[model samples]
Target chain A: DARVTQTPRHKVTEMGQEVTMRCQPILGHNTVFWYRQTMMQGLELLAYFRNRAPLDDSGMPKDRFSAEMPDATLATLKIQPSEPRDSAVYFCASGPGALDNQPQHFGDGTRLSIL
Target chain B: DQQVKQNSPSLSVQEGRISILNCDYTNSMFDYFLWYKKYPAEGPTFLISISSIKDKNEDGRFTVFLNKSAKHLSLHIVPSQPGDSAVYFCAAIPGTASKLTFGTGTRLQVTL
Candidate 1:
């Protein structure tokens, strides 16, 4: 019964709008990851956090995209002035830290559409 | 460059048969490989995994085989069922970052 949960299962917005997605990872899990999925690029990692602290955001566009884990149970991915290229399914996953080989558990993703 | 590749975009198999899905990688540093199964409108689910140290790993009906020399690995599902119809993705990690580099997934259709 334990699983990651995400909000706003689908979203549609005009270009240059702000979009925010939220995730509630499985209880007691310390690692969370954000990924973007597109037709051309397949799946790409955007960011990851360990123990509610950002570990890697190398795949994210710093100018407009930011990810944060304000608390242990909640994580968020926000995009400001979103562009058409940003239209894709965004997924959030969580797992125990590396001490366990941490197989990520994913939530049903949020599908974003930019007009 | 695509570090991992699943050249076959899709595969079709009949029920009660074995389905083989292949994946190739270019990075030799990748020491761990995993397979995930995803249904439409759902996120990918962990299926099985094998570390470079071992050539094969199995759990129930799923098995993963790794070939270090070729930088290749495969997932075999025995007695494929219609419920097994889903996209399968192969992933690898270069180091211990917990970050996974994934390949374009292969869609499998198990028909009766």
Candidate 2:
């Protein structure tokens, strides 16, 4: 069965450190999305990519957060000078881009805890 | 502004009884809606979906009802089982492969 895969299931870093999370979307999927989940906000869309091009990143902190899809299979989310308030579970999801009713397939998620 | 809203933060039901989770949306442009379920350590998984043109859709034990006029939708799980206990989220999209707006999830607990 095909599934979205994420690395470093859990990460703990000190404040002001840089953190990077990686995801491997299911083969053949052309759209990738990054989301942040927190108690106060639930699930917030951070960034999304279609056809390996960044479509939207408005939800992300422009100066601190960045998302990129270097290839069709790989997507990455990075945080520079990560803050304690940035602690939350980050998820990577993918779907067949532009499908009429596309359903996203999500990875297990990376649990990040910044001290 | 929160486009999607799940009024009930949590719901508890007795096993074998029916569980109904409600969700509301503020966006009139949403044409498709979906439901997802998440466990403690796992990501949200797609459960069911309904199109704006359809008022109701059913798949086995799960059914989704949509009311376009009110911009509301609901998920009904028949004969709720203990395994059904999890966080349920409601998501909506305005166009094809567009950014999905999600609601604050409702946690469901099915007890014996």
Candidate 3:
């Protein structure tokens, strides 16, 4: 069964450290999404890319967060000068067919903690 | 303002009984809705979904109902099982091919 794969299942770093998370979307999927889940904010969409092109990133904090799909199979999310407030589970999901109601297959997630 | 809301933070039900989870949306433009289940240390898994054109959809023991006029939807699981316990999130898309907006999520506990 194909699934989205996220690396570095866990990460702990001091505040102000730079952190990077990577994802390999399921083969054949054209859309990739990055999301952050926290107790206070729940699940929030940080950004998404379609066909290796960023379709939206408005929900992400531009000052610290960036998401990119370098190619059809690889996507990345990076946070610079990370803060304690950035602690959360980051998820990557992918879907096919120009979006629609197609259910997204999500990665297990990368749990990050900033001191 | 929060567009999708699962007001109840948690719910408990005895195994073998029916469990109902409710969701409300503030965006009148939303035309598609979905439910996802997540367990500790894992990503949310797709449970079910419904479109504006349909008021109800079901697969196996799970059923989703949509009330367009009230801007509300519900998930009902019959004969709830302990394995069904998890945090359930309600999500929506304003239209086809649009991004999703997720709610805070509701935790469900199925006990014997």
Error of 3 at B104 (Å): 0.8
Q: Where in model 3 is the C-alpha error above 4 Å?
A: none
State, as a TM-score between 0 and 1, how close model 2 is to the true structure: 0.97
* CA lDDT for candidate 2: 0.93
lDDT of 3 by residue, B32-68 (tens): 9999999998889999999999999999999999999
DockQ-wise, the better of 1 and 3 is 3
Model 1: docking quality category = medium
Q: Note the chain A TM-score of all models in turn.
A: 0.96, 0.96, 0.97
| Candidate 1 whole-model C-alpha lDDT, 0 to 1 | 0.93
Docking quality (DockQ) of candidate 1:
0.70
Q: Positional deviation of B38 in candidate 1, in angstroms?
A: 0.1
Model 2 alpha-carbon miss at residue A101, Å: 3.3
Global Cα lDDT for candidate 3: 0.93
Give the per-residue lDDT of model 2 (tens digit) for B1-112.
8899999999999999999999999988899999999999899999999999999999999999999999899999998999999999999998744788889899999999
lDDT of 2 by residue, A1-115 (tens): 8999998899999999999999999999988999999987789999998899888898999999999988887899999999999999999999975773589998999999999
Go through the candidates in order and give each one's DockQ.
Answer: 0.70, 0.66, 0.76
User: Per-residue CA lDDT of candidate 1, range A47-101, in tens?
Assistant: 9998998989999999999999999989999999899999999999998766535
CA lDDT scores, all candidates in order? 0.93, 0.93, 0.93
